[model samples]
Target chain A: MKVRVHVTLKDGVLDPQGKAIHRALETLGFAGVRDARQGKVIDLELACADEAGAREQVDRMCRQLLANTVIEDYTVEFV
Target chain B: MKVRVHVTLKDGVLDPQGKAIHRALETLGFAGVRDARQGKVIDLELACADEAGAREQVDRMCRQLLANTVIEDYTVEFV
Candidate 1:
């Protein structure tokens, strides 16, 4: 099974990278862009037997190592 | 309107970050993990009027600044 995890900064967190990208876009003539937030995607291939098991393991992975739970939020998707 | 861009490394390209994460997962006891790939996600909030226009602008953003076209591929999504 394949799983995808998306990790994004929580609301109100400062994202300098996203700000920089937004600034770059404006400089490039894309003035319509109002806001930009950057995040991460992790794609995993598992030897697990079922979607439920994969989700459980991946969720644990996220909680333990894949995400900074303090400042970021993550969502897991089966692909 | 909102748009999302997912940027991922092309197949056969080496990803040291993903490897490190996989190793860490194994050390933490998640043995079912077989492979891991890492990518970036950019979420944009635009003042654009239509989804079509937002997609066009976001695609340009990906091609120009959000993604490296040579070793990475990006997908744009309307949200």
Candidate 2:
């Protein structure tokens, strides 16, 4: 099974990287872009037999190592 | 309008960051994880009037700065 995890900064967090990207976009003539927030995507190939089990395992992974829960949020998707 | 861009390393490209993440997961006891790939997500709030326009503008953002076409692939989503 394949799983995808999206990790994004929490609301109100300062994202310098996102700001830099937004500025770069504007400099490139994409002025219609109002704001940009950058995040992470982790794609995993699991050897598990069940989607439920995989989700649980990946959730733990996120809480433990994949995310900084104090400043970020994560979502899991089965694909 | 909102748009999302997912940027991932192309196949056959070596991802040291992904490898380090995989190792960390294993050390944290996620043994069922067979392989892991890491990518970036750029969420954009566009000032455009139409979804079509937002998509086109964000796509150009990806090609110009959000992604490196040499060794990476990017997908844009509208939300």
Best candidate per lDDT, number?
1
Predictions in order: lDDT: 0.93, 0.90
lDDT of 2 by residue, B1-79 (tens): 8888999999999998899999999998888888999999989998898877777777777788889999999998887
* Ten contiguous residues with the weakest lDDT in model 1 chain A: A49-58
List-wise, what DockQ does each model earn? Answer: 0.94, 0.93
Q: For this target, which candidate reaches the highest DockQ against the unseen true structure?
A: 1
lDDT of 1 by residue, A1-79 (tens): 8899999999999999999999999999999988999999999999997888778888889999999999999999988
Candidate 2 has a TM-score of 0.97
Clashing pairs in 1: none
For residue B13, give model 2's deviation from the true position in Å: 0.6
Residue-level lDDT tens digits of model 2 in A1-79: 9899999999999999999998988888887878899999999898998888888888899999999999999999988
Model 1 spans with C-alpha error above 4 angstroms = none
TM-scores of all predicted structures: 0.98, 0.97
